[model samples]
Target: MLSKIQNTFILIVDDTPKNIQLLGTVLKNVGYKIIVASNGIQALGILEKIKPDLILLDVMMPDLDGYETCKRIKESEKLKNIPVIFLTAKTQPEDIVKGFDLGAVDYIVKPFNSSELLARVKTHLELKFNQELLQTLLNFQRDMVLMTDGEKVIAANYSFLKFANCKNVEDFNLKYDHIMDLLEFEVKVEKNDVSKLLRLPKEEEFKVKMKRDNGEYLIFRIKQNVIPEKEVSILSLVDITQLENQKSSLEEKASIDELTKVYNRTKFQQLFKNILEENQVNPKSLCLVIFDIDHFKKINDTYGHNKGDDVLVNIASFIKSQIRMSDILCRWGGEEFTLLLVGSNIEDGVKICEKIRVQVQNHPFIQDRQVTVSMGITHYLPNDNLETFVARADNALYLAKRTGRNRTERN
Candidate 1:
C-alpha cells in the first residue's frame, strides 16, 4: 500500500501558457512539484539544472517539436530514464506511432481528460520509482549479480562492474559466452545445456577460477538461480580468493616452525612416513641424519638465551641453504635438527653431514665465538620401522658425541 503522490517532480514543456498553467496546477495539487517551460529549448535548459521524475512534452511546439525533444531526452544518459508522456492534439495513427518511436511512454490529446492524464502520470511515476529502487538495491550489493536471458545480459549490478573492471555500463561488454568461459575450469556444461540449467528453479553453486583484468586468477563461488516468469537467470558471484589464501596460510603455518621457518617435527614425520611408504614399493637408497649443537647449554648459560636463540636460528638457516630441495629439514627439538635425505646411502649421508659440520665449525657464532655440531647418519634397513630407524640414527649421534664433540658418525 505505497502512497502514489509523494513529493514527485514533473516537468511540463509546452508553448501554450494556459496549458502549462493548467497542468502545473493539477499536478501540484496532487503533491507533485511542477517545473514549466514555454518551449523545448527552455525545457532542456531546466533539465540540466533539475532532474525530474517525469516530463510532459507537448508534440507541436515552436522550433523544437515534442518528437525532437523526446529524441534528445532519450539520447541523454542522465535524463533518459525519466518517463516522457506526449501532450498532443494529433489523433492520426502515424502521429501516435511517431510519438512512441521517440521514447514517449503515453500520449494525451488536446482537450485532454484530466483524469486520464493524472492516471497515466501516476502510473508511470510509480513504475519509474520502482525501477530506481531496484537499481539502488543492485548497486548496494557486495556480491556481483547479473541477469541474463540465456544469451544476452539483461542487467548487471555495481559489483559486477567492479569485478569486470568496467567503469560504466557502456564499457561492460559481457555476453552469455563470457559466463561459459568462466565455468570452463570446473563446471563443464555444453552450450546447448546452458538454457536447460537456467530453467532450473533451485539454486546451483559452483567454484570457478576467474581470471581478472590484472592477469591473476581468483577463486569465486558462483550461485545461480532461475526466474522462469522473467525468462532470465540471476547469477551471483562471491570472491573467495582471500578465504582460500587464508586457508593455505594456515596449513603452511601448521607444518612449519615459527622461529626457524622450517618444517617442524610433526611435518617431518609425516613426510618421512610418506617417503618410507613409497620406498617400500620400489626400494631406493634413503638416509636419516640427526645432529645437535655442541655445548649449547653453556652458550645459553654464559651468553644468555637470546644468543642461544640466535645460534639456533643461524644454524637452521645455514642447514637449509646447504640441503637439496628433495631433502627435508626439521627442527627436531631445542638445539637439535634432523634431515631426511631421499635417494642417499649411508656413505652419501656421512659426506653431506661432514660438510655441514665443517661449515658450522668455521661459521662465526654469537660473541665472536665458533660452534660445531656432532651428527649421526644411518641408512634404511630391510625391516626398519619408524622407531627402529630413528633409534639407529640417535645411537650414532650419541656415539659421535661420546667420541668427540665435532664429528660425524654412521650406523
Candidate 2:
C-alpha cells in the first residue's frame, strides 16, 4: 500500500515556464504525478476541480500574487489541509516569514538544488500521508475517538460525531468549547475541567456518561494517551452500558424465584443477615412473619399442579402489593413464604398480616374457590440469632395450624 504514496499528485503553480518545467521534472522523476499552472488564478481554478497532495507556489505572479493566493487557499475549508511550498527568488527573511505566516509548510529559494527540492517534497508528502492514514484507522474503530491539544479538539473520528449526533466538526464546535464539556464524569475532573483531564494519570481510567439526542444516556469507559513530543492527547471511549445491564440482569435472576418472580430463599437469608447486623448496631422494631397456604397439598391434588402454581403466584403478588418497599418478602420453598418488616413491631406485623389474610380469604383463586393463608409473627429481640429468631416464627406457624387453619398467631 505504501507504493501508492509515490503516485500522489503535486500541483506546480508558477508563472515562469522554465521554473514549472524544472520542478515538474524533478518531482515526476521521483514517481510523483505533476500538474502545471501558469499563474495563481489558474492554480485556484484547477484546485476547484482537483485536490493535490502538495502545491509548489511562486511568490511572483501576475493578477493574484503568491501571498494572496496562499491566503485564499488556507481560507478554504476543503483545500486548507493540503501542504503548500513557496518556490521563489525573493529570499529575504521577511518574505520567508510571510510564507510561513500564510500557512506555507516550507519555503524553497529559486536557486534550490534538485536534490534538496526532492528531499523537502518527500518529507512533506510523507507527513500528509501518515496523517491521512492515522485518520482512516481512527474512523474504522467501533469506539469514539478524539484528539485534542488540551484546549480544543483538533481531530475526531466518525464514530464520535455519530455518537454526539453531530453532522461534522463545525457542528460539534458550535455546541462545545471543549470535548470534555460533553462528558458527564463519574468522578474526578471537577465537572468539565479540561486541565484536570489533560493531567489525568496514565494508569487511571474513569467513566463518562453522555446523553444522546434521543434522551438516552450512554456510559463510556474513557482512556487517554498523550504524545509528549507534540503535547496532543488522544481520548478513546468504549460504550459499556449494555455489559453493565447484562450483569445486573444476571444478578437479579440469581436472587428471584422463577415461578412467582419474588425473592428466593437464599436471598432472604442474605438480607436477614444484614438486618440482624444493622439491628445490633442501632436497635429498631423488626418483625418476622412466616406464612403458607392453609391446604396447599389439597389444592395441588384436587385441581392439578398447574392450578396450584397459579394459586402460589396470586398469593405472592397480593403479598408483594400489601407490603412497603422496605419490607422483604421471599418464597421460602413450596407454598411457604417469609416476610421481614423493617422498623415494624409485633402490632404492626399483626395488622399487615391480618390485611393479607383477609384479602386471601376473600379473593377468588383458580376455579373461583376461596384461598386463605396462615401466618406466624415474631419480633426481633436483643439476644436473638438467625436460628432462634426463625425457630420462634416457625413454632408460631405450627400453633396457628394446631389451633385453626386460617388465622395469624404471635410468638
Candidate 3:
C-alpha cells in the first residue's frame, strides 16, 4: 500500500538529468519525498544533511562513480544500514554482480519497468523497517527471554546470555534437563511434560531460586508460553531478588531508631502491648522500668551539644551490653529510656535498676566525668491498661527525682 511510503524519503543519484527527473517523478507519485543529486559527489554531500530511507544510485557518473559512492556508504557506521539499489543502462552479468558486491540491494536496467522498480523499492523498505523494529525491542527489553524446542535452546536475548555467564548464545550449552538441575528450587512442570505445562493459562507464573554458574543465588519470577506454529516454547524471567531485599530493609528501618540504633518508641509500645496481653492470659510476673539521665540539660549547657550526644551514645551502649537478649530496651525520648523485663517482679526489677545505676556512676563519660541516672520501677497490675500502667511508673520516677537523684524507687 502507498500508505507505507507516505512519510518515507528517497534519494535519486544520476548523471543524466532526464533519468533523475523520471525516477523522482515515479517515487514522488507514490507518496515518497524525493531528493535529486547529479553525481556521486553531490549524493555524498546531501547525505551529510539528510538521511534517506533508500538510495537509487546510478552506475556511471563523472568524478566519483556510483561504485565508489556505494562502497563509502557501506563503510560509514551511521549510513551503512540504508538500502542502496543500482539504476543503470549496463546489463552485463559481470556489471550486475559488481553492483551487488558493492552493497546494492537490487539492480534495475536503464529500460526498467515502473511496476518492477516500485515493487523492489517497497519490499526492501519493508524488510529494513522490520529489522530495525526487532533490534530496538531486543535492546530495550528488561526481562530475560529464551526460545527453546523442549530439549535445547534455539535462541536467547542478551539478558539471558548474561545470566548464563556466557558471552554469546553459541557458547552456552542450554540443554533443558541440565538447566533444571542448576536451579536451587523445583519447577512445577514435570520433566517429560514441559510443552504441556507451557500450554496452561498464560497468566500463570512460577517463582524459582536459581544458583548461577558465577556462584550467586538469584530469585526469578518466570512465565512460559508455547509457539504452536514453530513448535517451540518462549520463556521469560523477571528478577525480583532486589525488590524482596528492599522490602525487608524497609521493615527493619521502620522499627529501629536511626540515632541510638535501638528500638524506637512506636515499635516498643506495640511490642509492650502484645506482651501485656499475653501476660494477662498466662498470669506471669512482668515489670516496667523508666529512667533518664540526671542533670542531662546541665551537661549539654556546660559542654556543647556534640559532647551531650557522645554521653547519650555511650550510656545506650553500656546498657545494651548489661541487659539480657530477652529484655527490650527502647529510646523513649531525647534523654529518657524504657525497659520491659519479662518474668520479673518488682524485687527483680529493683536489683537490675540498682546494678544499672552503680554502673552508670562508675563509668567515665565525655571529659572523664561521671554520669548518673534516676530510675522508677513498677510491676504490671491485673486490671491495668497502657495509660494507667505507664502513669504509675511515671509517678514513681517523679518521686525518685524529688527525693534524691542517682537512686532506684519502686511503686
Candidate 4:
C-alpha cells in the first residue's frame, strides 16, 4: 500500500513551464507544496518573500544562471543553510564538479527518472530537516555557546547574552582573540582575534575572566573544540565564580579564631604541613614564633574577662598588621600567638619577634591599665611535626617569662 506524505515546501526554479509542470506534478502528488520561479532571478525574488525547505534549480537559463543564483542564496545568512539540488543537462565530469563547487549537494539530469528524483529529494529533505533541528537545539540549550574561528565570536546563545549582560549578539560580534583570552577570565573580552581559532587544539579547558557591561565579573570555564567536517568551531562556557567563592568562604571559616578574628591553631597546623612540604620540594627558609600575654590571669582578675577578650582582639590585630604577606599569624588559644614566617631564616624571625616584643612594651595596651606579653621564637627543624615544633617554641616562651616579662627568646 502507498502512503501519503506530509506537505513539504519545494521551490522549482526552471525557465521552461513544461519542466516546471512535470516537476510540480511529481512533488504535488506526494503531498509537497510547490513554488515556481521561471528563472534564477525570479527564484531569488521569490526567496526574499518566502523561505523554502529545499530548492531544485535548472542550471541552463538566459541570465542569472543556477550557479550564480545558488551562490547568492548560500551567501545569505538566513538562506545559505537551505539545500540546493541542480537540474543539469550536462553530465560531463567538469560540469558535475562545477555544480558541486557552486554548493549544489546533488544534481538531477534532464529527462529525470520520476522515482529517482523523488527518492533523492526525500533523502535531502530529511537530512536538511535534521540539520535545522540540531541548529535550533544548539541555539536555545541552557548551556552557553561561544562560536569562533579562533579569534572572534561567530555566534552565542541567549544564555551567553544574559550572562554577558550584552544588549544582544552584536555586543560579542567580534570578541576574543585567543583561547587563553577566554581562560580563567577576570574580565570581559573587548576585542576578538579570529586568527586564534586556527590554533586551538581539542578538549583543552582554561579559566578566564568574563565581564559583563554592568561591571559584574564571573570566572568561567571554557572548553574548546573543533567540530568534525565543519567550518565553524564550538565552545562551551560555564560560570564557575560561585564555586570559587564558596571555596574561599569555606577556607576562611575552616580554621578561624572565633573570639579574636585571627587564624586559629587548626589553620596553623594545616598550613605548616603544606609549607614544609613545599619547602622540601622548592626549599625555602621558615621560622615559627610562639608567644603569650604576660599576667593574662591577673588582667582578667582586675579588668574582668571582657577586658581580657578585648586585649586579645587588640593584640591580634596589632600582630597581624606587622607581619609580611608571606607570614601566617594565628591565635594559639589562651593568650598565645604563633607566627609562621615563610621566607624568614632563624635570625630574621628573631628580629621580627624582638620588634613585636618591643612594640608591645612601648605600646602598653591599656583597657584599664598597661598590659605586656612574653614571646618565644624558634625555627622548625627538618621534618619536625607540629607537636615538636610547638614544644621548642613553647620552651623558648617559658624562658622569656622566667627572665621577666615582655622579652623575646629564640632557641
| lDDT (C-alpha, whole model) for all candidates | 0.84, 0.87, 0.82, 0.80
**Rank ordering of all candidates by TM-score, starting from the highest:** 2, 4, 1, 3
Model 3: lDDT equals: 0.82
Per-residue lDDT tens digits for candidate 3, residues 357-392, read 999899888656779999988988888776777788
Task: Choose the strongest candidate by TM-score.
Answer: 2
Query: What lDDT is reached at residue 199 by model 1?
Result: 65
Alpha-carbon RMSD of each model: 5.9, 4.2, 11.8, 5.9
Candidates sorted by lDDT, best first: 2, 1, 3, 4
Per-residue C-alpha lDDT of model 4 across residues 1-411, encoded as one tens digit per residue: 021246578999999999999999999998889999999899999999999889999999989999899999987877877899999999999999988998889999999999999999988888887765655776777777767666556666778767765544545553433434544343333344333433356426666676666767777787777764565678787777899899989989888998888889899888888877666422236777888998999988988999889889999998888888888999988998998888888888888888887787677677446678788888867667888888999999999999987888987
Better model by lDDT: candidate 3 vs candidate 4:
3
The count of backbone overlaps in candidate 2 is 0
1-411: candidate 2 lDDT, tens digit per residue: 353746699999989898888888888887889999999999999999999999999999999999999999998989998999999899889999999999999989988799999889889988888888888999999899988776677888999999888866767888888666788887756644665566566654677898898989889898888887788888899999998789889999999999999999889999888877665423348899999999999999999999899999988998899899989999999999999888788898899989989988988886557788899999988888878888999999999999987999999
Clashing pairs in 1: none
Candidate 4 CA-lDDT value: 0.80
lDDT of 1 by residue, 35-143 (tens): 8999999999999999988999999998999999999999998888899999989999999999998888999998888888889988898888877787788888888
State in Å the error of residue 73, model 1. 3.2
Best by lDDT: 2
Each candidate's TM vs. the true structure?
Answer: 0.67, 0.78, 0.50, 0.76
Q: Can you list the residue pairs that collide in candidate 3?
A: none
Looking at candidate 2, the ten consecutive residues that score lowest on lDDT are: 275-284
